[model samples]
Target: MIRFENVSVTYEDATETALHHVDAHIPEGELCLLVGPSGVGKSTLLGTVSGLVPHFTGGTLRGRVTVAGRDTRTHKPRELADVVGTVGQDPLAHFVTDTVEDELAYGMESLGLPPGTMRRRVEETLDLLGLNELRDRPIATLSGGQQQRVAIGSVLTPHPRVLVLDEPTSALDPGAAEEVLAVLQRLVHDLGTTVLMAEHRLERVVQYADQVLLLPSPGAPARLGDPAELMAVSPVRPPVVELGALADWSPLPLSVRDARRRAAPLRARLEGRTPPAAPAPAPEAPVLAQTARLTLLRERVTALHEVTLALRAGETVALMGRNGAGKSTLLGSLVGLHAPTSGSVSVGGAAPHRTRPAELLRHAGLVPQEPRDLLYADTVARECSSADRDAGAEPGTCRALVSELLPGIPDGTHPRDLSEGQRLALALAIVLTAGPPLLLLDEPTRGLDYAAKSRLVALLRDLAARGHGTVLATHDVELAAEVAHRVVILAQGEIVADGPTGEIVTSSPAFAPQTSKILAPEPWLTVPQVREAL
Candidate 1:
């Protein structure tokens, strides 16, 4: 269905080749997963398949890429739209229409499909992606995750033979992500559609992949083969594969069920001991932020309702739930992006909504779901320098933070040219330069690979230890298991559960980390915890 022949890509004004001699093939009706670290040309490779590289991105393509036997070099993205449905990393950029239902039907209308067929496919896609309640909502009013689902449904309604998705589940919550993946599975198995997806959250999709495409580094040779074989040697790994390696299991198990079948003795070894987790904040700790009976409305929809919460010094909290469950709303309220409809929100002894931007900088800083929003400077150096001046910090503080999170990023590179994860690291560094007492992150790990995420985890742990309070809204359960002292679950614009991380995540099957599920009857939340226990 897809083939890459001696593929090499070099962008205009770029010294190093973005992709170097990547030769690969995918047969029809197969689901291929593209795996690599940040800035390693995974997106570039996907762009080739969709004809976005040389056609739209102004890059030089030295080799041929074909989808369904049509050469991408000879065809543009629109010319190949009938056979290929491509969803890139940013959902907002993918939408051409304003409303959910209209966006879903737009692709089919472009294809000149009959009105009846378009309507039927739109309805089927809405049900398949669980988007019925949001059919009429403006795309801007919906949450990030909801927009992502709509973006996917739009392409899906066209019924393209080959579906190319980049970070398809990045914005989705655990349940929503599963639903989206299930829809992709049906497209591959029942309908014989070819799906090529690139995702950073491998734990959620690795088990479902039919074949794995491993790109070890930037511009390296691509490796494509059985999922199990590639996962064993891939630089990045999911929790299941990491655990299998820790236990020295031969060939490594790809799913929880397979790992469980071989874990009788391992369970015996860990029967009496529990995994160690970061302790929750002390009751007497100084309050950095708090919300009292807060209610917020957006587009007449109750985004947050009668919610009361608190964040204390030296604490890291993870806000989690299904898509559009008020997690982002709460974060916005704390950072003054959204004023509450009723009730009160205070940060650093002042109401965030009423505080000025300069004063609010001392109280809190936010790295939103879209990292690009916080960055406006042209180059990496300028952004960092500007952040330093705004925060009154030393000149190199932001640059050093970026180095710690993502090393080797050039100072002169345009922010737009950086990968999603690289852009996020720059945004985070800018936020941290202010040295705010409270830090807020929405889906901070969206594009980060395992190694990048580990650096962030360590950095957050260090920040908490230095008496800063952190609240991050996220769908990455593995991250919460590793770094959070507390976990708060919200649903339908209300707080449903809040407690120690291990207690809250382990109790809920849908939100539990992979290691916790494999080692059930115990509250183990990470592979590192299991390794430490042994």
Candidate 2:
């Protein structure tokens, strides 16, 4: 059991405490989920368990933290390594080996385990994560999702009693994410391992949690309870499930299958309801920002083939594909971060590769997949205004625009100090303030809650409506359905499918249909659409 008795942590060089005087207990072998908007010290709480809070990361501490009856204050991270294993959001930062097989065996080898036991454990871990095919492959060559699994596998092979994971599925596509979750579920059930995970993607893991620890916001207290009970009160509640409850359904459905089952009767009752008249149809043959035979090469690999595509003005396009299938690379090519080897990539009648990085900022605004690397300023407001200075725009205008998107935070606070959701919002506001005609967002909703996602959808929809072309590379099919007018699927660095939102989602096996589509897989991407379709 992991217990915190009035534990409070305050990092040096910060004015406020990260975690308040908090008391919580995680029972043995319980699949406890640590959830909140972001930054509410969820990660800090997990760090305390593994001796990261006061040991690796120096911080003022009060009270005590005990794991399995062992006092955490007495044991540093290296001392607790045998009992606790942790996987952070950034997996690559913790890697100790170059290959998957070697990485899995590194932990056991460090503990002085015999060669035979280490080999067996490595084999078991590889099979558990379904990474046997890539056992000998280079760690750098693996996709983001695969790397996340390898990180988990590397730690799990040590047979640690407690496994702490931070946002494990934030970087994964739908199919790959399911595989990782399945492996984690098996660990809790079959190995009797205690799991404590902090994540923003609640819809994927809420049903599996035995206990939910909900934090309100930064520097605030956290609430703990059964997963289902907490979901009802959560500000970032899952969309379909929340809609089901709003519509007065009995025993709220947690998964798509359960949602379908619950909605079946409702569909029958509402079958005869008349549909509202259709709104004026958008123009046929929409004029898109055309890319004529675009080709890109990264060393020997072809990042993008001679691809011809069109992204219509005032329309949202979802760019979907397997990881390492060049989703980010394509976004980079369009923003002049990477020059194409052949052909041309254009946005708003100008070639991005030919334009200067500063000049390109005016035509297309890009939000990279990893938001941390993009942030350089000390404060949130300063980060937003950095773009203004770069583009020769007024700082006052930039501050006003950022305030409009994210309201609660003061302009003087540090950007890194804010929650993950808030940081994402701040970054997006900066990008949009540049007044670009085209926008390229790569996994912009990665660490956000449902509430933040809703705000993002509204913002993107408004931007598209205002005649700004938008392209979003994302794993959240649900977000794509709600905001995007069109969907394009990429496989092995080539366009495999492209069509309207409804058609591509329903047809693709690689893609999991959105909740709205799962409820009603035709002519719609929302709950209202499902209700009306019935």
Candidate 3:
């Protein structure tokens, strides 16, 4: 259904090619997963299939890319719309309409389908994606997860033969991600639809993939094989695979069930041993931020409701929950983006909402979910310099942080041209340059690979050790387990659970990391913990 023959892509004025001599064939009805490290051109490869690389992105494409037997070189994205549907990393950017129902119908309308067919497809997609109740709601009011579903439903309504999704489940909760993957599985098995997805969260999708495509590095030949075969040598791997490797399991387990079945001996080895304890703040540590009975309403929706919380110095707290569970709202309240309806939010003894921008930066800094929102300069150098000036840091401080967080990103490269993970690293460096007492990161690891995530974990740990309080709102259970001292779960604008990371993650199946799940009843939340235990 999809074929790339001697394909290589290079952006305008770019030194490195995004993809080099890539040759791969994805058969009809197969769910092919594109896996690689951050900035390795996974997105670029996906764009080629939809004719977005050289066509809309102003790049040079050599060789051929054909989808459903149609040459992408001759067809633009709009021309290939009927054959390929692409949903990018940012769902908000994909929406062209205001309401959920309108968004779903927009694609079909663009294709000039019969009104009856459009309506029928819209209804069918709404039901298939579990968006029935939200069909009449405005797109902006929906939670991040809801917006993701709408974005996907919009593309699926057109009934395209090929679906190209970039990080489709990045913003979704575990349960919601499963639902989306299930729909993809149905499309592949029942309808013989071709699905090509690029995702950083391999643990969630690897098991479902019929074939795996590994892009080891930018400008390198792509590898195609069975999931287990590719995973065995892939630099970036899911936690389950890592666990299987650590335990010397003959064949690496892709899914939790398979891993658990092979974990009987490993489980017995750790039966009585306790997992290492996570670090904790001192009992007398000062409070860096506090929220008392906070309530926030947006467009008549109670985003946050009478929520009380506190952040202590030298502590890293992870805020987790399903989509629309108010995790972002809580971060907004702390960062002064949203004012509470009924209660108070204090950061460093001053109200965040009333705090000046300069003052707020000194108190706390926020790296929003959309990393581009905080980036405006044309070049990476300028952005880093601006961050230094804004944070009153040394001239090269921000640049140095960027190097530490994301190396190999050229200083002269346009911020817009960077990959999602590289952009996030730059944004994070901008925030960290301030050296604020409190750090706020929302979904910080969205596009990061395992190596980048490990670097971020180390950075967060160092910050907490230096008495900087950190609050991370994320759907990454693995990240929470790695860096979070305490995990706070929110649901429907209320705090549902708050405790130590080990305690909170192990108690809930949905929120637990792969290591915790594999070593059930043992409280091991990470591979390192398991390794240390043995």
**What's the lDDT for all of these models?**
0.92, 0.77, 0.91
Worst 10 residues of 3 by lDDT: 515-524
Please provide TM-scores, in order, for all candidate models, with all chains considered together: 0.99, 0.90, 0.98
Deviation of model 3 at 263, angstroms:
0.6
- The candidate, 2 or 3, that scores higher on TM-score is 3
* Clashing pairs in model 2, backbone N/Cα/C closer than 3 A: none
In the range 308-425, model 1's lDDT, one tens digit per residue, is 9989999999999989998988988887889889999999898888899889989999999999998899999999999999999999999999999999799999998898899999
RMSD of each: 1.0, 3.0, 1.0
68 Cα displacement, candidate 1 (Å): 1.3
Clashes found in each candidate (C-alpha, N, C closer than 3 A):
0, 0, 0
lDDT accuracy of residue 298 in candidate 1: 89
Which residue pairs does candidate 3 place in steric collision? Answer: none
Expressed as tens digits, the lDDT of each residue in 1-534 for candidate 2 is 889898889987776788886778998778998877655578788889999888987888789999888898999999989999999877888798999999998899889999999988888887777889879888986766678888988998999999999888888888778888888888789878899999887778888889988887766667888776777767666756665775676566667677777766665655565434322116663554566677777757787887778876687889998766778888888887877787777765677777877777777888876566678889876776777787678767667765665566667777766655667777777777788888889888877776667778878877876787889998888787677778888877788888877678867645644454444632335664555554
Instruction: Looking at model 1, report the run of 10 residues with the lowest lDDT sum.
Output: 274-283
**lDDT, residue 159, model 2:** 95
Measured by lDDT, the strongest candidate is 1
